[model samples]
Target: MIPSLSEATIRHHTIAQSFERGQGYYRAGSVHSLIQRGDRLLARVEGSEATDYQINVYFDQGGITRATCTCPYDYEGWCKHIVAVLLTCLNQPDRIEHRPALATLLASLNREQLETIVQNIANEQPEWMDAVEVQIALLTQSKTQKSQKAPRRTTVDPKPIERQVKRIINRYVEQWNDEPALDEIREIIQKADKFLEQGDGNNALIILGAIVRAYVQDWMNLDGSSGESGAFFEELDDALTEAILSAELTTSEFQQWQKELKNWQKEVVDYGVDSFEMSLTALQQGWEYPPLQEVLQGNITELGAWEDEAPDFADDLAWIRLKILERQGRHQEYLYLAEAEGQTDRYLQMLTKLGRSQEAIALAEQEMSTAGEAWTLAKTLRQQGELKSALNIAMQGLSLGGSNHYGLAVWASELAEGIDLEIAFQTRLKAFQLQPSLPDYLKLKELAGHRWDSLQPELLDTLRQSSSSLHAKAKAAIFLEEGLIEDAIATVTQLSSYESDIIHPVMDAAIAHRPDWVIENARPRAESIINAAQAQYYHHALNWLRRVRAAYLQLGQQEEWHRHRTALMQTHTRKHKLVAMLQQRDLT
Candidate 1:
């Protein structure tokens, strides 16, 4: 069944402009043909295009897990069409026609009927012929074919996949909009992953090798400004590494792969990324590194893969081994490997899973070093139903003061909501002190309730102490939020440079309490723009002028405002555009 959807959920997934725009589309009844098939909502939203766009929203008991639209709206979140469809669902639930899920409908059909349906679909869309062939082959695998060794490898021609990779790279090269291209490339790599998972690592290696070659060839042409390209290359490297580990390679192939991975690792590092370096180690440790075997057999006394020193990718290698063991359902070996290698997260996770909750908790307190580690275990323990323990560890980790304290505090506070008020307040208090943002302070205020008056001064002190430019906006915002108008004025005054966003709010909030300071600050900003003859920026000058006028009027100094306006008009008499703007705004 679909979860309960709300307007807040819809708005959260959409940008403000997109949400408002979607509301317009919904009001115009653009979202039509809405249908709910089990946990999926499918609809066509009429928008500014030749054809209507399709939207699919997938949900479960948790909430809307995914929402997608067949439009080119891939900036950060859901597109307008998706927003409109969800809004329609929330407001007009009766308009949604309910239908059985596709799996349920398919289950009702007999074998012959399913075959006929497949034939019809193939006739209608011949592009699905490949899937049909694969399905047929899978269902008809012979007994001899089924009786294969581990890591059964199958080969594929890399030419087509290589062409697809090159096409994706070329398309994203110009705009540096490599995110969508990365998505497409990752989809291709995921296909190889599926093949590798099914023990057909030969085809997986071919596909992964083709993708890396293409990606490395023209990677420099694409813009990595989004910081996503680095992560994309890492995924490609990881896939190549996994494929190499899984494939049964000839000795020469193994050497070549190791050498090529070293070269790829060198080439891709220009983007400040360390990729394919893992593939090198994977090749070095392929299937039979003696120490790895010893470690797997619960021998921790041996140096084990590194001789008295950890390798560059020791953690990554340990993680990879743990994943392999977990995948093969070798839980005992997984536990031993995790413990032998000091894989605290994996080891504690297994302990919790194995019903050793007290041990996991004790070990978490003693062994976890970073808040990030404790944060992860706290979440794991919470999911494992050790709520009180999770909250306690989170609070303890919060005191450790690592980079993840703010994030862990937030997680712990939410986890403690309706469970323990003091824990919630303490975590949130630490979060606000650590960050000192207005939003955090406000949320802390709500949690502090009657204790806010006592806590308010301490929060305000934190804000006052946040002198970095990074926290300037938040500091000023908290001043305004707390009705500390004079403090808001002082905060804005201290900034050496004017950021209208940080200063303007304080000015607006201080017009009644500190109009003289507003005028003193605003006039200089307005004069700088007007005097510099920046015609394009005259509107900014006008805005500052408007604020100055408001400030003077708030101070009951209208005649003073008139004198300042007339003097400014006379001084910029040659700037006809500026004068005209003043006239247009009735400041003549």
Candidate 2:
């Protein structure tokens, strides 16, 4: 007997929400025709859309071994359809036991019988006929010895692919629907992958190269701040890397690829494309084209002569040369090039790798006249276990104070361990004073530990006097955690401004213990959120309203809740989008 699908298995395949949704789907009789075939359980599940999705689950006594679905839900291993099918199987395992194995029935049929069955299936579903047509043609042709026309050789054009990518980017920019854009990009990448699987590396390269060129061009035109575009470029780089890894190329083929790459580079330069230098660098490094590396090395050697005409190209070649050297374990050569290139990061990395910490420290000290260098040197020293030196360097860096002052404070706190507790506490407090971030405050509290009680009054006084609301929120949170509920409430209520980060926590803490306080306090903030929210951010306001409603429901203040909601609807009558959202959530 096969074991039932466990809750653990459902959670393993998908998230909790999907599993819960699957449960609802199962309960609604959406899963049907569940059949057991060998170790697999198969079913059809009706989805939100009109078409039903096919679900396949491979299982045994241990539980589900594997599952798959035809639904386009790719984030998780198995989709909700699969989960629903599994639930159906677990609930009524006997229903599937009577179903005949499809493969066994197929094996029992004769060749002529199989042909008749195929013909019937083809008649019912014409789309199925395409797969069998080629085999049918081959069989008939052998019997008749008939002549066949030569198939047309279609040329692969990169333009269509490039145009489609550009169109998707433009659509995303106009509407900001990321899911469809990402799906289209992935589909395009799958096309390239199919070409690669068919051993057409050149065409695959062409498709990916076109995408890179288009992305770079678009990045040049855009504001250069859209992280989505950057993510897409990274995905292209990954695809290119995979394509390179999977490619099987001869010496001449590799040389041809190298030529094509150089041509692509030239095209990019001629077009003055910018902001995909890293992508290009990744492609070059991934290619590992031996002849190109050799040529680049030679170019690096003669860079002094070509510096006037092709200085940028010479620099690119030099960087590639350094990468190749590093790959070959030619560290000394890489170090020389790095030093010549004034790449401090690379220089320090090589020094550390070569176990030349003393030289690294000396170089860091020489550079530490600047704040950035001082922080870097201090971090390097700390990592190298020279704690005393690290502390002194951090102090020196703080004294210089040319920005990244928060970094110096963090370093000082980290290095102040086992030295002076008071100094460490002061350093942490200074870090909080500089940034007023929650993490720094948490760190300061942790450092204070048992002494936090003794330090509370002074800390509260300092926070109350501070101009930053972030500090005041931190003080309120500290008070809340310490069980000084009145103090927390008072501190939070005194704030003239309201931020969600400050409001939500305070509301959550007060909701059960002081429902009236939460009701009185959160109403204004929720209204402010609703008033300030744009069409795109109406969902946030709805969420805040939901929380507010939950608090009212808990307090048995349905009348007050209804009145407040009525007022909100009347006040925001012009915001049809927000009103529609509220109606959808049944909040009205």
Clashing residue pairs in all predictions, respectively, total: 0, 0
Cα lDDT tens digits, model 2, 249-308, are: 457856765665555556456544333444344444543444334433443343232323
Q: What's the residue-level lDDT of 176 in candidate 1?
A: 57
lDDT tens digits by residue: candidate 1, 1-588: 244355644643566568888888889999989988987889999988999999988754334646888898967567878888888887888899999999999998999999899889999999999887877766886544543424554468888888998888788777857678888888988888788656676678888998888788877666756768667776776677777766778889888887778788778777688777777878887767777677767777646555467667677777776775664556777887787777877788888877888998888878887787788777777766677887888888876745888778866765676468787678777776666665567667767889988988877786777677788877887778778887788778866434887887788888888888989988998898888898999988887888899989998889999999889889989999988898865453
Model 1 spans with C-alpha error above 4 angstroms:
1-156, 172-187, 190-201, 223-235, 250-256, 262-275, 302-304, 493-501, 507-588
Q: Which candidate achieves the best lDDT against the true structure?
A: 1
Q: Local distance difference test, per candidate? A: 0.77, 0.63
User: Native-vs-model 2 lDDT?
Assistant: 0.63
Query: How many clashing pairs does model 2 include?
Result: 0
Candidate 2 lDDT score at position 231? 52
Which ten residues in a row are the worst by lDDT in model 2? 143-152
